[model samples]
Target: MRIYLAAPLFNDIERSFNERLTSLLEPMAHVFLPQRDGKLMRDLVDGGMPLEAARQLVFEADINAIRRCNYIVAVLDGRTIDEGVAFEIGYGRALNKVCLGLKTDDRTLLPSGDNPMIIAGCKKIFANTIELVAWLRGGFLSARDAG
Candidate 1:
């Protein structure tokens, strides 16, 4: 299976965690980690590419990767879900791809809970990477069947 790991990648802590997660998931499936696999806006800009062109290239690369993947594993940590991650989840759903969530944080905007739309988008929500890995290892027959 090919998995599109959707997560925040703006800072060191987030990027490092994403790499660690990618390593864990690599044994189970081909993981398309944007930080590692796709074009980086910073690098492109530093290399003399215009900001707009770099942004476009990065966006297209990620969108194409998502199109080719079988699943989207979204990291739903932080007080609020990352905006880009939210967009990816919606896009994945629109394309009929399975969406799974990894929510290590307890914070939420709603007094009730995380947004229903977000919750409904995911086939399953894991509390940690271990749980997510375990679920993936089980073959995801239910997820496939649902789709």
Candidate 2:
């Protein structure tokens, strides 16, 4: 499966986490990330570029990557939902792609009722890295089965 990985990319810790997650997913399937350089937009801010331009670049790149992938695996562990991840989820759902959310944080932080990461129509939500791997490898049998 061509999987688009969406997550927070503003901080070093978050970027490293995403990288590790990408590595974990790569062996099972093709993983797509926004930046080939592995530098998040915030990292570019130190180089004197305007924050707005950096945001635009990241957003465009992420959207383009989402368009090229067959499914979306979103990281939903931050204090607030990453805008880039949210946009990717929206685009994936709009395109009728299979959407899977990975929440590394405690479930208690989430609301009691429904999963916020599931969006309106998404049904799959994995709790952690292990479950995500299992779901990706076993639950998703084929590309046609994803949707």
Candidate 3:
């Protein structure tokens, strides 16, 4: 299955996290990352393109990737849901695509109230990488069967 991976991408830690995720998923299926062009958007922004324009480009690219994929694996571990990731999840959910959310952050670390949107949007959720991968592979298979 083709899977669109959505996560925070602006930070160094996020870049490492996404790389690990890509490696993990590579053995199972095709993995699509928004910044697949080796920081082309970042380079554009650095070269004086407005930050807003760069952000719009990334968002549009992510949405297009999500639309092209059959499933979404969203990383929901940051202090808050990354806006782009949230958007991808919502789009996938609306399309009736299999949605799996992985949270590296502990529940106790999340701020006060539950994030109903994330909970409702994801068909499955996992706290660890292994569990998430297992769930995603299974879920993708199930989705294929249902379709």
Task: Give the candidate number with the greatest TM-score.
Answer: 1
Stretches of candidate 3 off by over 4 Å are: 37-41, 48-53, 107-113, 139-147
By TM-score, how accurate is candidate 2? 0.77
Question: After TM-score superposition, what is the CA distance of residue 108 in candidate 1 from its true location, in Å?
Answer: 1.4
Question: What is the per-residue lDDT of model 1 for residues 1-147, given as tens digits with 9 covering 90 to 100?
Answer: 899999999999999999999999998789999999999999999999999999999999999999999999999998788988999999999999999999998998788888788899999999999999998987655666778
11: Cα error in model 1, Å: 0.8
The candidates, ranked best first by TM-score, are: 1, 3, 2
User: Could you tell me which 10 consecutive residues in candidate 1 have the lowest summed lDDT?
Assistant: 137-146
TM-score of each: 0.92, 0.77, 0.82
Residue 90 local lDDT, model 3: 82
Compose the digit string of candidate 3's lDDT tens values, residues 21-138: 9899988888997656223477778899999888777667777777888878899886678877787888899988888888878643456634788878998788889998887678
Residue 88's lDDT in candidate 3: 82
Identify the superior model by TM-score, candidate 1 or candidate 2.
1
Local distance difference test scores for all models? 0.93, 0.74, 0.79
lDDT of 2 by residue, 19-81 (tens): 899899898778886655334565679887899998887667777777777778988775556
Which ranges of candidate 2 are over 4 A from the true structure?
Answer: 35-39, 43-45, 48-52, 107-121, 139-147
How many angstroms is residue 2 displaced in model 2 relative to the true structure, after the best TM-score fit?
Answer: 1.2
Q: Which candidate order results from sorting by lDDT in descending order?
A: 1, 3, 2
